[model samples]
Target: MVMVEYMDNVKLGMLDGFLTRNHQKSLKSLFSRNKSPNANDNGDDDPSSAALNSPKSIPQLSPFANSVVSRCSKILQVPTEELQHHFDTQLPESVKELLTYARNFLEFCSYQALHILSSHPDYLNDKEFRSLTFDMMLAWESPSVETKPQDKETTCSNQEVEDEDGWSIFYSSSTNMAVQVDDKKTVGPEAFARIAPVCAAVADIITVHNLYDALTSSSDHRLHFLVYDKYIRSLDKVIKASKNALASSIENLQLTEGEIVLDVDGTVPTQPVLQHIGMSLWPGRLTLTNSALYFESLGVGLYEKAVRYDLATDMKQVIKPELTGPLGARLFDKAIMYKSTSVAEPVYLEFPEFKGNSRRDYWLDICLEILRAHRFIRKNNLKETKKSEVLARAILGIIRYRAVREAFHFFSSHYKTLLAFNLAESLPGGDLILKTLSSRLLLLNSGAAQHDLSGSPHAKWQPKLSPVSLIALTQLGFMLQKDVHLDAEAIIVGDVCVGEINPLEMAVKQSVLDTGRAEAAQATVEQVKVDGIDTNVAIMKELLFPVIELASRVQVLASWDYPCKSTAFLMLSSYFILRGWIRYILPSIFVFVAVVMLQCRHFNKGKPLEPFRITPPHNRNAVEQLLTLQEAITQVEALLRSGNIILLKIRALMFAVLPQATDRIVLLLVFMAAVFACVPLKYITLLVFLEAFTREMPYRKESSDRWLRRIREWWIRIPAAPVQLIKPDDRKKKKSLDDRKKKKS
Candidate 1:
């Protein structure tokens, strides 16, 4: 039994050469038996009688072929009894007819299956193999039929044109029923619809077959060369048929009246005309007419209506010209905004480039001319009856143009600065200064500082100040003294001079004392006067109110000034640093380092490296090494003498300096002012430090583009350092839960 099985395996191994010959014989017998005149004449007989009348020459399969059939049956999961029954009994007439037309298709599928199984015996279990087999079955079940109408005269009138490549072109005069023009001939929309299904089917088949071929070819095992050759031929036929159908449909199209000024293929926004929803732009043929613009769909059967815009009524306004980039131009260009009383929204029409020529500007010019002519005709007709009204309209038009020009000029001059300031005021730092100052005032009023103020009128009060407030006040005082030259001593706080004290601290102290004095005076007035009026509280209000007002005003000004100061400091620092190091000193250092590193190794080793070594030596030992080093040095000297290397080095140095040259010069001047001219660098640095540290405070958390936050994260290494790692089992459970949710969804 084992020996017999080995022999059977050897026979099945040689089945590739025999499969094709066997298939041809089987196909010939199948066709001949079905096409017999007597069998047809009998008509719908019993299967046994039909088999008896059929041709006696039944195609016999070898044992190998039978084994192949059995293997395919097993792979298809067909029952053994059903498989035997299908082979033994004759199929019904209708099935035989379908099989006769699909002979080549069935043969192709069977051969493909055989090829896959021969190479990959486990292909029966492959998902890709199952999908491909299903696709092949669907293709075989639905055959392409010529959808020609069955009128004898119409069929006779049809012209059948054939190309050298075997593409059939059928044109019937009856198909032009949809576009029955008195003076012109054209293909109707129904003609495209009739042939669209066949073209779409061919396209789908080509796509699926190509994908299958690609997937199968990418595997480790190779397909038979003939199989690929046959697939390529099938693909070429379908593609050619699709192209010919599209071309024929377009060629038969004719315009109704106007000569086509421009003809191109593009997409138009779908107009809700019938049952179809207007959701996306549909591909269509765009044609520009002398009096109107028209767009017609390329595909048929879809409930899409042709879009038409009458130049006389619909061209209400011509929008300003915009230059769309390459990608936009491919989509559509020379967009015109159009409106009509009938439609709620304005319709946008675009003229795309046709072939290599873009007639967008030409089309636009013609449209404008049409609009102008129409307007002129209407005005001429009305001029005799309404002369005064026409004159008023002309004056209004002139006034409108002049006003628009002046408004544009005004905006161009002043709008940019105002826009920048408005944007700056919206940032978090703008509100931050106000909040910080308000919170500080509230703290001073509510804390023990209020009690200290109530104790004695002569006692001086000094409230604690936040670092941010202190830095802001110091910078403000420095600016006031230097720029405005205002003496801080003009504003007195308690018994001390303002210039001799911290202004913010003094303001907070005064506000706290004022609140305390007001409260105490109110209590005393309620006890003594009974009129709810206190003289001390009123007096204290006048004296201490200005201090709080000044502090509030300073906070508002600081918000505006803080950003400008920080920007100026950064610009100056960058300038000074680049000029001092990057431009001149850094390049010099890089050159010196390169020269030292490249030269020092040879000096220390007493012999040059391979690329710079000398060919020979006058003596052996130490003298030889010294002489070789001299030769290497001479080579280096010769290389430097060529001037190319020196020029390159010079260029490298200049390349580093050119980009930052202007900025460095400007910053150098600012740096000089800050260092030598007493521009208050310490105050700027202190303010910068305080701002950076408090950048993430509660009030400032709304800031989006936080460079300070990024800097802090980088310094800390891990932004979320306290986060815990998930265990492997927990991660698996989470993934499983997610998958289950996805399945349910």
Candidate 2:
């Protein structure tokens, strides 16, 4: 008997449901119409696809009408015109379907509207109720957006006026627009009158399950478990079938084309064909089908579950609501029925590995394989003219892959939110249960600590993570470490630094120095020159440009996360500038100051100075050291050039790092001018300025001597000569030379 019942469930309704007379007319008109840009906007495109049409014509119209009628019958006790007014003049066919869907959904609420109508004894006898139901039917019947309200007014003639206290209501008036018949009464806006009832009706419908329980007074009259289970199984099968159908259709549509060739050169090729053009056809509808299947899975899953839970069971037999949905049914089974049977678990395949050479890798691999098969088909049949068409197919395949990835990503993000509704319904406590579920999900996502890093012995077993997973984990780490609670610096340092100094950390340090502080500014000139970090500065500068470009890209892809990108750019750029100023410009300025001060002191001490000479014991070595230091300083000076200065300023503007009190605009300007003057001439003028210029110039001879020392220092440092380091052999040779020089002396 059970087998027979199951077999009976496979009964097919004709394609008749799809081939309605109105649909046939619409289809005929669709083909007849030009569909050109200048096509007329008459009723040709639409032929009364209204939910208000004859209930018998549609596959599932009776349930929809019954639901609405049950709700309207109670509300209709109020005058017909007033009830009609609440519908807000004439509703569009789309809105009418929404009303119907809302009404059907109300049945899952436990038939609250039905009980309200049945309990109100006067509701049935009321003539206005009948008239209002008729008016509602008319509201549904008028199919086109082009259908005027004036025609509806004529159809539902309004003559009777009912008065009670200050309220005067007209019954189904010709122009059903809500108008004040009572001079003494105050009415809310017409828009409010129309929308408020729909909201209330929806709310009332949502509350039906509780109302049904109250009305029925039977705990056993809840929902059936098997019905929803069957529906869910069937729906899942339908989705899979749909997917398979689409895949098969796509495979079958492959087109073949013949090879063609063109030679630009005059010399003819010996080959039979110059080029083979291969292609495969793809339907645009496949993309639409994919989208529809995804949404259908979501919707049908919820609906089937609702129907399962709304089933009523007494001692001997199971009774079910006509409109129970999948979600409500699932809720009923888990919460009320509380069955503990071991059901056959539905099969869910594992998520495909997204980083590998296999077919299970990224969807891109699958798409490329499909394209290859398509190319083979075209080549084999010699129908290769459809190259562009094949290209479009490949492009569509890529787009479809992206769409699927995006859908999966969205599902991953909000899977809990959608599933939570069902889970919350199942559990006794709402929010508390949700919290527990959330905690569990977080733990699962965190995964196990003992996941195998080394290759596991089991051949069937895959790695716990892939390249995409690592990338995702890195992104997740970034998000988690962004706040003040986590050490963002440590995380960045650990990840970016694979072997040596962290590029990100080095960039950040450079930025901090660029901002300039007391310690940085006070460092000795030689110390600054020796510790000069041009390599880091250059790395940071180059890194910053990409970061800036990345930030702009981030703005396009996900604008909300853009501040992070901007900060990355600004930090690197600032570091580059800071290293330049402290290492190069500041050192030169210090040298200048030191020379000026020495000149001042010498002049003040005495005028008994011999003419400046760099010849022996009193001179050249100190000058050579100074010159060597100067050369290093000059290299930095050249780097801190005008073009770079302008680049930094422009970068600063583009990044929008507003200049504050500590930004040192004046210092930057001064350094730019100094670098421009001194860097090009090997810092020669800088050496002169340091040597001769002084505030106290009364002793002119001392100033001149200071100038000579500075000039000698500058020349010796940069002269073209071989500076040799002595190895063991060189040291022995140097000692012999020294001994010979001593003997000669």
Candidate 3:
């Protein structure tokens, strides 16, 4: 029955819940009229695909909607009246009746205008195209006068700018023009986040805000056109170069079918890449593909057979930056350590540079992007072209990241990573975004079959033109996927919608919020990181002082140095045990802790927390501190050895190293087990408590000492278990191929 249930879920897919089934057709309807829809979008005879014929009975749009329509007219080279008429005609009656009618109409115009602009070779390069599109998004935010309210800060007037940086965001929106944007005009994070991810191959929604932060980091977080233009163009240059770079080592690397090469290193003599296995080191050529890493060592002035380290398969792989040196001394931090289940040991690739490991860092970032992309693919169990699409997306993202790195020389932070999938894996709510994206990928139809626009099975998705970036790349003469082909006219439009945040964008926003909170908490932690071990120990000791004091008091009573107190404690403890009141001890402790917390909160309401006061250990020099740590470790080792010796003696008795002792101990155990099984638990506990309580009494002290001494003597006489150590098997880790023919003699 369990197996049947498991198989059902497996068939449905682990992410079945994330597949946006029955997705409403609001934005889909608006984005329906691309320059060329996918074959699956609609049949040629479909009425919905035909040119719009305005019906004058439709109601007039609001002021905001009128402005959006007018701008669309300018971009399309059509009259405002005709554009507005076309928009009203395309509006489904069911959609026109909603409160969001004007917003939907605005989205309808914006989508068509953007689609037309997408065909132009320099659309992204055009300042007006960027500004007009940004205004469309702003108009979508405040679609009509009736929907307008507070949060005036969201408008263009209060653009995100810092005066201290001698720069401001864009000016207020014009009543005539969409947005009065120019060289001085600025944009906020939200605006950039919305616009950039549309070029999904360049910016991912999960990391779009981070990418914005990266671009505007030096500009006081105010996104100026200069920075935005530079970044986009740089990324553009990177994509163009990277697409052609795949051919550099196609035959030499021998990449498998469908594998796209990401990056390669170690071609230059002055900047040779060193491969280290154990204590041996040699210069090599390293290549990274979407699936694996290949390193070919230089032998006799030529590269040898490449050793492949698989990344596409799950192998609990660990890749990180580490230091390496001659003879394994680890004196330089210019290497990457790659370890996986497929390899017997970790392999280190060192990028030798004169000063820093910038070269190494680049290799690390690109390699990790490919590694993480595959992990995401394997985690979701994606298949075929969908899998190819994911790898292609990752490949493009890395190239763009490299472009920015090369142009700006800026390294992204943990919260501001440039890689999309890498950011998703690191961000808090990113799984939901990935789930939505993965489901959306499966929605793209790659067949010759056609259906009516309204009746198409995937009509709910609206746009089927993605892997848009790859399509863009292919158009520019670079080919990554031979098995998968997308519509030639596919243009990347992200998941942004008409006056509504899509689920994927919502997840991204939430994750970015969480990331900000995480960075804040980490900042607080950084502020409190004490350097000295003695200071840390002092803090811990202060925190646990009450528990330490209680244990000391219990020890004093058990010593019986004060007979009256010891007797009273013993009787009280026994009485509590007999009444079974000790069962409530843990609950009582919890209640006490809660009360203490409340009391502290009440008293500290208007005050900051009092500083923790501790008389730290005497100040010591660095050498003295090191000596203290070593001494502590030595004491712990001593305690472990003593414990092991005691266990070994018990092992000897169990194995009958001494027949008399074994028989005695075995009978003693049988008697204890029988007592536990047959006797009432309360009576047994009372008997044990009484025996220990009276052992330190004045009358029995002498005999107790004598008995303890005898017990010690007996323990010392017991033989310990013998131990043997065996050497590990030594085999050659890697062997060269042996030819079948014998050497000529």
Candidate 4:
């Protein structure tokens, strides 16, 4: 009878192996020690069920429980919604269990028959029950499986076994226990055979709640801790696995018999700091890469913060043509000479009243002392290298010396009065300066006497006009002056609104102008006065020639030019004054840039004999011509405001024609070629307009001539073109040429 039963059992086992090959391995590892493998099989009908009741050979399942928990914990970190959905369609796990595991709960079985209750179709109808079920799923942990009517203990027979070395009592053989029969399943057929049919019967009770829906529905605190802890732990493992690329070393880091997770040891290094920011698992490939980029961005931002505080401040002091060493001393000497000349003037002659009290007085003394130290260092025959130190000491002396302070007091009082006068006029009356200047110029040009113009016939009538009269009377004279005023006003508004100067016009003009200035300045050598000898004096004269030439141009600008006249001159003067006072306090680079800009402007705009001028038509009244000029100015100004603010039409025209226009490709091509040729930064940014538009340009040809030719062709094709002159004789000449060509052909 035992032999027949054994044969029947073997046949059943083989069939089971075929049915659950995949789940068998896990089941063998999970339920291998269950004494009653057929505990719920209702085997009163099957004779072999009685044979399975022996307990001697059954391995203990308690040890495998931790391993099962650990495995689930690690898997929970993965994007499991898709996987859970797949399992839902393929397997028979309850919806609650699917969601609980999907949510990565640390404990999954705490709520009473949660999966069973959630599986009912009617569960959705009871909002409260559904809500409660969701909360349980989020926070659930394992509990003993619910007791069932079928859980009755069966009286089993005990057996004895004899081996070569020993005799033993066998309650059950290993074969009869939950031993793996195939690689198809995690739990054997014997384990689920009893549960499968029961689960299938409860299909009507199943719900399909996913982790996302569960989490969305519930806000339970207990569930949060379980979900988060497990999720984080799962993430830690996932990150580690990802780093290792799911290699074999993962398996080698195995747990002990009953242990679920590997314990942290002194040997293994801790996880990176970024891992602790959240209570969620490590991200997948795309998310992980994005996270790494964000971390890098944060690191860069932190470094930039330090740069702003420390390095940027220092950078402001460096990168200057001025204040390097020798150049600063020369500027200081010039300033002292200017101060001394000014002190001899009528306004500055009486300096006594200023001696009592003033901050301006204090700063002036500092400047004077610096100048004195600089002179003293030279006069006493100090070492050339030590001159700067002495100058610095002289600066300190001005700050501290009493006699210097009195001189400073006079200078400071005069400076303050001048500054206040200029500020009031420049800031408040600035609105009217250009208008007044234009009106004054227009009046000068219009020769009609005031008394003679009072009741003349033309008083009631507007006069006839021509384009030339329009250009001369309005734009070239009156309207242009008004336009300057309007432009200045617009600039102020723009600066306030945009929080920056609109250097577009200035930048465009400077683009070409800078090249000229740079070349000229470079040609000019540094100058030093020679002692005693006639040859040394000649050398000094030669050395000083370039600077004298540049200074002469500045004098012309200071004497003439609308932008530098009156208020303009006063504004620039005050700028220099303020600059001198704060030279030590502020960075030398700022002052250097300012001075370079001034010198460049003077050379470019204040040169003798300007090549172009706005001439009037042959005949027209000054008033009519002025109105026409005003309209033209208005149109041009509007165009400038709309686009390419840096290049006004007049300036663009000047850039086109002036400055030896023959085959030079223009600033744009020159800039592009330089960039292609990897030019130095100072030269690189010389052409501001070109630099702005083509900043990201890839390298191309370095030949400026080729580049220039192309640019000229492009410029000719552009929409804006200057008006051309036509001659009646040219038409006759062209006809004859055409006739001759036809005869030749």
Candidate 5:
């Protein structure tokens, strides 16, 4: 955190520029809708956003609060009046003073309501449930016009200091207040995480902040009601379309039981999916299921037999974005390359877009999600319905991500992606989150765990059985696994209790905080990168100047550039090596470096690091650089080819490809082994040392040259093994393309 603050100083201008750009863009968008708007985010309106646009729609509690409360009532199955009465009666007087405190009330109602709704089979698919819950988030962002200002003034003017507990100390510091709320009444990440997960379909508590960050990234990393609403609405459409698609896939694609269709493309002739198998490209309909990828090649007027790409089972699957082009030349970066032990070769699924590869990226993300989810299942060894729960969670998260990407036309960056598995993989301390999730999953049923967690229940706090999310998905008609029979009396509570933080949630929060620091650190790193190869090399050289100077002296000694120094240095090194003091010399150098660092730290206490000074190397033009590169490449290629040929000859000798060569190599190896057996290692080392030491001596020069020449002649006489190249069956590919060209012609 301290380092992040320091890094922030390094990239303050960059962050400011970023926020300013997004802020202006957001303002412009909102201004087009509203006569006058807030400076922070461009709020959306289906209910709350709609109210924000019209001054007349403002009410006593504001449509935002009313919408939230109304949704809460439905979840609680209580009337709105009774809900408000409960809130008024149950909450603390100090907390209930402002609309901001209403978030706590909303959390209470929404969480409990979510717990109840999560059990309903149709809750995830229910359009009204999604609309209401997301509307609650939108409403949470910007409240009633009257209440918003009042709350803002109340927060700012409340200087009445009360540190009744050690809490008020947390509220102020260098500037009057330790922590202060911003004037802009936007929903915070914490609030989003707390409320968004009310519907398992909306968010998972573990990755809610990431989802929020993804949803809000374009609006200066502030949640906008518009983005949230569009995302939820898009998700609703996607879910419904997927359900509809199942009916059609049932006849053609024999989907595995509990396999929910995720997405399908290439149904239209104009936007056909191009599938490349060992170079052959075919247009086809590609369907992504909960478990695998199904490709049905378009043939004659009918689709050929569907090719299933297993994602659920472990077949050493590797899915990544790769370049694909006509004839498999890899000229275009618009394909998902899938390679697995199950498939004969890598399959390229190309989504042709004239511009950026959004289509490819989309497919890549969804496919990886299923891949990673199954991996998680495998890694954790989840069985039966537990597998279903994990799979369903992944399914919902992907749906949410799809909704956001398609609706907002914006992609969440690495740290803020919505896919749970992807987010976990990318986030720092993410393994801890996964571990916590594994523990959480163990509490899915039975009201109690049978496993001996160190022997007794009274000795340790046991986790409660709460699988509301799984229940929600099951109710939504996904039917992920047949093994899970929901207990009617199972405790319907959130993974997180009202006043307590779940271990998984805490892990997520920690990861989120670490991610913020990582982003800040990355920003500073980006700022410090010197442009151009010459400049960067110059900086590197300057940083390593001491090491370079030492190396130069050693080089001078080795080449005997100065006879006196060379003789003295050689004597000293040889004495050290012979005396077995070489080991201590490196340790001594390490100690010296450590002392220097500590001394520097002591001398420069409370000060910044001194900037290294360096002058860039002379710049070379393209032609000069190219000429140098060509010369280097020529030398390197010759060396590599020579090395490879020698390796091949050695391989041939080992495999007895040639009888004489193999017999000679075997004899030589046997002799060497006999010598090694007979001789001590010390004698061998001494002999090697003496040979290297005397190689350039005048008396031994002739003999050494004769031996080297003989060895070179012998090596030249040894023949390289015969090699053959295997070309894949690409005739079908050529034929396919040739036919297509002819048809076009």
Candidate 6:
């Protein structure tokens, strides 16, 4: 009776399931779409080809699914209706919907089974059916057999469909889609698809078991064990299949003329061609051969080709090791960065620990050995050339490498100095330094006999003088002293042996002797020039010659009596001209014009420069003379306290230390100006127009007081008429009112 029942189930499965006329039609349609005329012409009897051509449709009464379902039902003694009811009440809305679909599909299966059984009565007693049924009931479990007609016009070639139960649908080919069921997300479709029907049957079995337990208050351990056993077997099959596929992929790579030394599972980063950004990681197998390194992605099709790196061609490439941290240890310990000569950036390959050894270190050592061997081979190949020629070429290569390295270092240091120059040039005293140097240059070229240092005896001493010493002497007003001797290499001012000319330290020391506090100044200069004074002092002395002369001129101007107004005016004009021309020509001209305009306005407003209104009566007494001397002392103290003289001295000292500071700053500014000039002229004109329209003018009414307002108003009237035509009535009236108010007070 049992054999008869098995035979009946087998016949029903074969007649109503995948072998049915409808399934054959679907298979024929799929084959026709993929078939070529050449494939039809070949009558190959290969088992693999036959298997590939076989219909992949699933069968009804599948051994894997049906066995689990039948065993659980028999143990629980639950009807199909009871299981469905339990599922409806206990499952979520989504699961309930899936249950409904399954039930509808099962009803269709039953109707078809009945139709087949009625039509083929002779299949009931077939021995072949009985044997096939027994075999299926024992162990047969396979994937589903749902067939959907392929849409050739579909835009999406490989759309992924997934469900909440960790079930995924993959397009197995352009004409077919397959479903896979797995514990986690990483399992391949082929493995899980083979067991998908079994999974569905297990779901049904579990529902029935739970329902029976709820009703009887008893758990069926036998049914539970059977379900778990089937699941474990299914997972085992998946693992074996995955390993086989991996081996097949590795074999297909076809490495060139080398034995594989090492093979490991790892990941390599993939970057798009042409684009410079966005790297994606692909998990793959890494194989190191004697001749090359290869990486094959675990996936099929385009990914199976595997990227190859030839050891000989990439001899100069460097491999860098990087530790990605503890979290990344699961995937890899260290990543190897390979810089390809053809690519803009390096490609990274990460390796996990392989068999208790560090894969990164092992791979790196292998690559180093290969590189060393390649270098040796290359060296031997060069024996054909003359030894002398080879030696000369090698020497030239070494020199070129060193030259490039030193040039890079020099540029880096100078770049830092250039930045410092830019920062200093923006300060207020920076303008003064430039002006002072310009005036000295002008004085030297003006044919002034007193300023001609080139023919002076002290000119010879200038070469020996360090910039620090020159600065110290200038600060002490030594340049203006008449009793200075420069006949010898040693600088001498009066009786002092200031400094010697040979070594910079000696020169600076000798120059410091001219200062009143020689010892302290010498010590300070030594401390500042600690990093070898020769280069810095020589560069400074050469570049800042004009600045030193200007410092002397400043001292001379300060000492002058300015006995007449005309003399003082002429001196002030010359100073302004020299300062303005060097630092900022346009702005200085505007300033000078503004000053002259204000003076003219003052004259037109009937405001004359007045002398002191109250003066003490002249006295020839000694007490009066003493008072005058005390007043002079107070004025000198005030000038000193104001810090102007000290600031000027500091500026001059800075020039001595940074001799090329002005030149570097000017060069940078000019470069920036040139860059700006390259912009469209219209843009510059627009910017200037906008500034003029929006910027607050210096002589605006809000900024001016009553006296300034009168002066500006007088100037405004001059442009409309001659000087006499402008009326001073308003100014005179205001002045009279002010006088009356002063009298009343």
Best by TM-score: 3
Ranking by lDDT: 5, 3, 6, 1, 2, 4
- Say what the RMSD of model 5 is: 14.7
Q: Write the per-residue lDDT of candidate 1 for residues 277-352, one digit (tens) a residue.
A: 1233445555443345556655674424456666544335443334342333434445555455645565554444
Off by over 4 Å in 1: 1-244, 247-669, 672-687, 690-745
User: What total of clashing residue pairs does each candidate reach?
Assistant: 0, 32, 2, 35, 10, 6
lDDT of 6 by residue, 1-745 (tens): 2332232222222222122122212211321324332333256454433333332222333333333333222212233333334434433343235323442223222222222221222222332222222222222212122322112121112233645632222312211221221111112222222222122111111112221122112112111211222232333333233335335544666743222233334433442111111255556666554346667666653456667766655346776565442333334446676666754665667665435324455455445444433443354443211221122222222222222222221111111111111211332233342233222222121110112244332221111111222222222222312223322111111101101111212222232233325445557678645222234545566567777887766444443333244346445555644454334667888998899999889776877545323223433466665776688789989988656544653454446434454455568789979968796554554455433322233333244355567755643332211123435887798899999999999
> What are the Cα lDDT values of the candidates?
0.34, 0.28, 0.65, 0.28, 0.67, 0.34
Pairs clashing in candidate 6? 58-145, 64-140, 498-510, 498-511, 499-510, 499-511
Of candidates 5 and 4, the better by lDDT = 5
Q: Tell me the TM-score of each prediction against the true structure.
A: 0.17, 0.15, 0.76, 0.15, 0.70, 0.19
Q: Which is better, 1 or 6, measured by lDDT?
A: 6
Per-residue accuracy of model 3 over 107-179 as CA lDDT, tens digit each: 6557545644554444444445544555554555556667552232213332345355332333111211113
- The clash tally of candidate 2 reads 32
Model 4 agreement with the true structure over 101-214: per-residue lDDT tens digits: 322222221111222222232332232332232223222222122211111111111222435533221212222221211111122212211111111111100111111112
lDDT of 2 at 244: 53
Which candidate achieves the best lDDT against the true structure? 5
CA RMSD, predictions in order: 44.5, 33.2, 10.0, 43.1, 14.7, 43.3
Predicted structure 2, TM vs. truth: 0.15
lDDT of 2 by residue, 1-745 (tens): 2322221111111111111122212212321213332222463432222212211222232433333433332232222222233332322233235434332222211122222222222232333333333333332333223332213332213343446631123212212212311211111222111211221111111112222222112213321111111222232233234335444433333211211110011111221101101121111111122101010111222211110110011112111112111322221111101111221221111111224212212322322223342433343332222222222222223322333223222121111112222222322343343343222222221221112234232212211211111112122121111121211111110111111222222332343234245334546443423222443344455547766786667444332234455456445544544444425767787898899999888886876545322222222355675786798889888888744655654555445454441255456678878988767443444444333332123345466667778866743433232235679988999899999999999
Find the 10 residues in a row with the least total lDDT in model 5.
Answer: 13-22
Worst 10 residues of 1 by lDDT: 490-499
RMSD (CA, angstroms), candidate 1: 44.5
* Residue 38 accuracy (lDDT) in model 6: 32
Say which prediction, candidate 2 or candidate 4, comes out ahead on lDDT.
Answer: 2
Q: Sorted by TM-score, highest first, which candidate order results? A: 3, 5, 6, 1, 2, 4
Candidate 5 stretches greater than 4 Å from native: 1-106, 116-184, 446-463, 481-491, 516-544, 600-614, 617-623, 645-745
- TM-score of predicted structure 5: 0.70
